[model samples]
Target: MPSPTMVASFRMLSSQRPFLRHIRHTPHWPGKWPTVSHARQLTTGSRELEGDSPQPERPKRRQKLRKIRTLDPTKLSPRDYVDFSMLRQPNVELVAQSSDLNDASNALLGRLSATINARGIRDGKFPPNTAGFLYYHTPPYSPPLAGEVRFRITPSPDTASLSEGNDLLTEYGIPWKIPLLHMTDKKGYTGLQTLLLRDGLVTPQLLDIATSISKSVKTLSRIVGGA
Candidate 1:
């Protein structure tokens, strides 16, 4: 009963039904109509939007370094105690005046040299009385002497016989007097006194001789000890 043109138009409408339904369910469509190109454009736009979405970037981690501490030599005060047993043989001589090569008093020089040498050899140790030898050259230039004149021991070359008294017994008698020679002042005593006291009481002359011998012994000890 329908006309031919109307029937053709109905067939065309039936063919587009699926497309119309698809467009009706799609988002952002102008109307219930669809085209192949429009569908392709929508799919491409969706892909582009997904690609442009932002994602969080991860944070970078840093490496930790270790701290180092440095030492200060000046701030480090090392207290050193000298061992006499390790002393080597020392050069010994008595001098009368202060000369370039001969600047030490004969008696003082002889006494020191002998004392240091003998003790080193006999006891295999430096006599405690002569401990001052290690620090004789150290400062403060003049240390506490218990209110006595501070004398600095210097090296000398003038030779003198023990039998003949010299400046040591005359002018510097306080330091050179025999150990038995009593003095009100304790500061005037020499290393020989202490050494003798440790062993036993002896004549001042004998102590002096012994001290000189010790100095000689110390010089030999130094050589042998080193070997």
Candidate 2:
């Protein structure tokens, strides 16, 4: 029913399909074929699909310790009595009881402190002693001292120095330098002396000294007591 010229044009266009197929199948085709990919893959990932911005490598925090030192709750050794009786007559009592000389010294100091405190003195660390202060003297021993193999027995800064304010005075001040006429005092003696009142009551001699001081007040008053 169509004119011959129009019919011929339609046939010509239809025949080009095989020629186009041949061009696409050629190895030298300039177009790159799409790479086969797993169904899980997409050309572009959605924002949500990316792992949360590599959790911005959280600024490393210094490891915190729950407790600076984990002390053995078990009693290391029973208290031993140290005699100061030999130093004086009428030995009334053992001056102190402690596991070691350090503890004994501490006990003696505690007694001394009580006596002084009773007389209304609020002086701080009357005698400062830090050499054997339980913290700095924990050297490892051949036979484990008194417990199972322990870890971090010594105190940690996080636990020991939590109160930042305490060190402010120490940091800014002369910083715990011992005053002296050189080599006059042992570190142990100097340190333990602070706890002198921990065990014993004030001696009678101290009371006598106090009485003398009170009586002498009148003489001093006459010198400075202007008419």
Candidate 3:
């Protein structure tokens, strides 16, 4: 038979067995109970990782674009300045006395004067009422005139005047044999009448009266400012 002291000791050990199994089965440190210092170190490491966690990346700031300054063409030097007067003027009178004048202006004046003198053109006028004229930045508007075709003129090829003039002749169905002007007779004024008739430039009855006047006049010299 067992004594009372042995029985009491066995009962106490049985009660502690469950507590020992619970400690062994805890998942915190696998099979071991965590020490106070080690638990504190783990807690501190977790806090550090949280503190060092990367925040959401901020968006990059866009750089501002540079502002470009606009240049005024008129504000430039006189030679470089673009003259807008040609757009408004029906007839531009050019004098090459000033060196500051643009090249086109000077060239037009010289060329037109030379052409007029060479052709014995008394009045700075050609047949069909066309005359050489200048533009803002361009050479003389060849076939150059400020009449009906002045505003219609644009920058064209080197032979544009000749070509357009030919086209105009074709449009009017005028034969090439008719001289542009007559040095002696009134054929040029008569041709002008023909052109005016074809293009309907003026009323028919009025043109007929003008034609009669042109025929009655002895020479174009008086009309063209020549004695």
Candidate 4:
């Protein structure tokens, strides 16, 4: 019973109501969209995580190596120090003196004098037959002397006389002398005698003689020098 215009208007209104209902059920519909509570919670959780995280610091570089320190020789103590003036010489005579003497004289002279004083022979002591004497000159050349020279004088007779004295000679007689003959007797014979007896081959007797000579030399050295 409705009029034609009214019927048309009612049809249009019905279509618009269905469309609005569809829009209201959709998630992104502006008029009836869902609340953003879950999204906001996720955003807040991300922000809190970012705030709790710590940033890593960078590592530092290593320093260069330093040079090693060295000890100075001048600051070090001397190995040997001796007083030559305090030393005593028995048969040695001081003939000449060095003008260019240095502080090292004590070390040099003390050592040399000690070596000589310990090896010197007392009065009335005969020189060993196996003993040999070596004389050295100022030029410092050792000239060979007879083993029987009966003195083991150092610095040479002429040179020693010019530089020092016969005191060394008097203290320790010639290197080679009749006194060493007794040592040979104790060992039963000389090296030459043992060699000749053995037909040029070294024999036990020769070895024994050598050993005895070595012992004798050691004894003499010990007696002459406290060392």
Candidate 5:
């Protein structure tokens, strides 16, 4: 067994060992020591305020798009991607509604312009009475005629003007041809009539006309000024 003095001496040295080791190993920073960093990411505003080590620059926020990218055309919205109001409706008809005589004249020209009618299909030509004039239909009214509709303002080419001149042209209809559906008669006008009939567009009026050509002539005359 060791003496009490020696035992006391050993305990004293053992206690001092830890203290000496800590003094020798204590870390010393050469410059100002750093403070605790934030647990969350810091932004430019935060860096300015906190004065801590700079965080990695935050990725820029994504930008928005004018239009969505998609394979489906039906999903597209025309109003968004395009300048909707900026588009021109050149093919659409514009006319004065107050002109009764002008409107009547246009109606007659339209009837004459019929290439496919109750009578059948004719050579797609405007009649001789309509020769000097040209006709156009408002796209909205002329197409897929869900019900009866009116013709557009007739284009009268001035006789004083030519295609080369503005003054010499005076026809109300165009020289260019437009394909239109017409009616039929008992005689059954042309193959186009059969096609339209097969397609079921030769409405009840034409069937009546076919059943009674002379009888329906009055209805025709009333509508077109002559059978």
Candidate 6:
């Protein structure tokens, strides 16, 4: 019951199959089909080209070190050395036996060493030896060589200096002791040695001389009294 036109169309399509098949089998790239060896060579060539191409250089990695903050000895609390060992002379052998004590000692020493190197001695450098018997030594403690000796070190500003009401001399005009200079009767005292004991002027050198003089005076007094 097929229509004449439909039947004719179907026959035309069937007749074109062989032509289509020939077209499909023909190489579309204008060459014969590649053999197994030719295919291998093509793949190897592509690989070689890839290998020969310049590669991007990787960036060098650097190790970042952590910067440690230094500890301030002045800021250290008394509790830090509460049960801590480390004491004077002949008993020096008994120092830093415990792990806590040892760690504390090492930390203290390291900080002290760094501090001394930074600003301890004269411009962080030792003085040149004048005498033949000058001792190059380090003390167990570093005290303020100049200025008034203070037992307590705190970050808080001195309240006495800050207080306006504390200035009694300014308000009441109170009398204060002043430094005195004693002169010998001799007109030209070439052998006279002057010493200053003001809080600002007193130094270790002056202190040592004063101590020796005091001892000598006491010894002389004792001898004279016995006579």
- For each candidate in turn, the TM-score is 0.16, 0.17, 0.19, 0.16, 0.19, 0.19
Tens digit of per-residue lDDT, candidate 5, span 1-227: 89999999999999899777776666643234334452233355566688666779889965232221111222222221211111111111112112456544334322221221211113323233221222222245443322121211122333232232211111343323223322333232233233333334444565454446545665777889743
Of the candidates numbered 2 and 3, which has the greater lDDT value?
A: 3
Better of 1 and 5 by lDDT: 1
**How does model 3 fare in lDDT?**
0.35
CA RMSD per model (angstroms): 28.3, 21.6, 26.2, 30.8, 22.1, 26.4
lDDT (10s digit) by residue, model 2, range 58-152? 78865321111112222111121111111111111223344467664546433431111101112332222211111111125722111111111
- Badly placed stretches (over 4 Å) of model 1 are 1-97, 100-113, 117-133, 137-143, 146-227
Per-residue lDDT tens digits for candidate 1, residues 37-133, read 9889889999999989777889886422211110111111112111232343333222222244553333343343222233213434322333211
Model 3: residues >4 Å from true position, as ranges?
1-154, 157-185, 188-192, 219-227
Q: How many clashes (backbone N, Cα, C below 3 Å) per candidate?
A: 20, 15, 2, 13, 34, 0
Judge candidate 2 against the unseen true structure and give its global Cα lDDT, from 0 to 1: 0.30
Worst 10 residues of 5 by lDDT: 82-91
Candidate 3 pairs with clashing backbones: 131-144, 141-144
By lDDT, the candidates rank as 1, 4, 3, 5, 6, 2
lDDT (Cα, tens digit) per residue for candidate 4, span 1-227 = 99999999999999899888888777655564336986687689899998897778788864322110111111111211111222322122111122455644323333221112223445334333312222211112522111111223323323323223232344434332322223243433232222222232233554456557767777998899985
**What TM-score does prediction 4 earn?**
0.16
Model 5 stretches with alpha carbons more than 4 Å out: 1-139, 142-171, 174-182, 186-190, 200-227
Misplaced by over 4 Å in model 6 are: 1-3, 28-52, 65-227
Higher-lDDT candidate among 1 and 3?
A: 1
The local distance difference test score of each candidate is 0.36, 0.30, 0.35, 0.35, 0.33, 0.31
Candidate 6 per-residue C-alpha lDDT over 1-227 given as tens digits, one digit per residue, 9 for 90 to 100: 99999999999999999988887677653246778998898899999988997889999874322111111223222222211011111000111112454455434332221001111222333222210110011124633222111112122223222222221111124311111111122212111111122112344464455446556666798999999
